[model samples]
Target: MSSPQFSFATTAEEVATAFSNEIKGKNVLITGTSLNGIGSETARVIAKHANLVVVTGYNEARLKATEDALKKENSSANIRRLVLDLSSLAAVRKAAAEVNSYSEPIHVLIHNAAAAIGPLNLTVDNLDSQLATAHIGPFLFTKLISPKLLAAGTSGYVPRVVWVSSGAHAFATGIDFDALRKPNKEGYQAMVAYAQAKSANVLMGIEISKRSKGRVNGYSLHPGVIYTNMNQKPESIAEMQAIGILDADGKPSTEKFEWKSIPQGAATTVAAAFDPSLNATPGAYLDDSTLANDKVGAHCLDAANAKKLWEVTEEIVGEEWVF
Candidate 1:
């Protein structure tokens, strides 16, 4: 099947046009935004439409700058910043706790911050950095803030959590159950690790949605590859170049692929967060801004795996979840 291309060229204003005054009072939080990435643009767009926009990243200065920029666009916009390092469980937990302090309910939580690397690395907790940042940290963060989301709106409908996953997840043959803890000397297959992390993200979303049972929505989306930093990390770029995946100028090697502009890359995330029509399908995989029935590998879609991961994550974080 031929894959369709989507552009992220849409500006923040263009994407925000889809939303209406109904979204005006909604509280929205976006993770992984920095000055130059898609997250910054996501923050820009959310700040325009949502009542409150909580922007988060590891860089304090950049976070403040993005917050300021958003404020300039919408002075009435309630914009805040949280410096979070998703690779660290301690930081993630702290960030979650801080997010819970807000009295207002969060209408939408976008898990858009994730990592792609060409080398195997470990976090402070000795877990795979990619996996922790992409799956575990975001998972815990969502669980922590779910109550706030539930409190924001009616009991029947709470906030939605959208996991910004990647189509690369289709490449994970199966999850490495023990590999997450044990160091594999296989010399860092960036593609495999990225795929595994993304698959886990999808599974995590499904599990969270199942637990919510339509009270809230959860989505795993592959927002067609935009030429964003997340997809072109330094190590991965070197690895791709060595393998002929990229050309001399570092462009994707003549592969039939969709490269979205920043706004377009963020389209599905914004839609999932604010689109009321999607309320019915609380747990679904989204691709190219559409509901996807693309059958993931058995393990990627396995309820058993999701539960195991959840249980193990709780053990790692050493806390009881309120959500």
Candidate 2:
């Protein structure tokens, strides 16, 4: 089968309008919008088409700013902001509860928030900060939201969730079940952990799609490298630069590689979230808006491993998954 060619020269608003039309009356709860980052831009784009836009982030001020911006553009659309810190399970549960309290069914969820912890660092959960923010936190959040999504799907909402994964996910070996902490012995190892988390995201998304059959469509997409704030922090941006990950231009050198302008970076995600053709093709890894069948992203293709990761994540969260 031919893979989908995911490039788009269109503007972000055009992509947003196209995607929003797919779920015009559906509720969309987008996380990580409180920060001045890609998530905010993504939310703004979605707000243009979605009936209700729920924005969330850890910073109250940034969240408010995002909310105000969305409302300014679409005064009549229902928009709300909730401060959420995905690093803590408590916060994840609370946010999930709040989202579930809504009477409307949620149609889409985009997991775009991630932290790149370069130096060896641990969260309060004794997990690597990158792993916590990128993998564990989002994993738990998905678990918490599964019931609502399942309900929505059963209610004829055709609920869907999109995990904003990355091509760097190809670099990881797989999840380490024994060492859930993934302690980094070297600086380079930290980058490996980040890849592991990203790979896990793709796997988890695939698993959700497989498990749901055609009921709830879940997908993981690699938005081509766009310059984003997740790379701004020292531990992240500096480390990548130190390792020659960036070109002399000081930006992520996607010239020799592949990079997307913001709109192009958002293309695959929009396609996965809205394309009518993909409504039946569940559990597929999408790179640039097409199914990835090559060894290019093999780590995310392990169905058994994905099931294990799902089971372990559920055990850690101490809750039963709804879907």
Lowest lDDT sum, 10 consecutive residues, model 1, at 1-10
Give the Å error, residue 46, model 1: 1.7
Residue-by-residue lDDT tens digits, candidate 2, 225-301: 67766766666776667656677656787546655677666667766677666765766666666666463476567
Q: Judge candidate 1 against the unseen true structure and give its global Cα lDDT, from 0 to 1.
A: 0.75
Residue 266 of model 2: what lDDT? 65
Backbone clashes (count) for model 2: 1
- Residue lDDT tens for model 1, 1-323: 22123234544445466665546778888898876677878778777667788899988988888888877877888888888899898898899889888777888888888776678888888888888888778877877777887777685456788888878788887677676655475766877888888888788778877877666778888776667676477767876677565767788775655466777777777666665656777777776555674655667777788887777777766765535
Q: Which consecutive 10 residues in model 2 have the weakest lDDT in total?
A: 1-10
Compute each candidate's TM-score over C-alphas: 0.89, 0.89
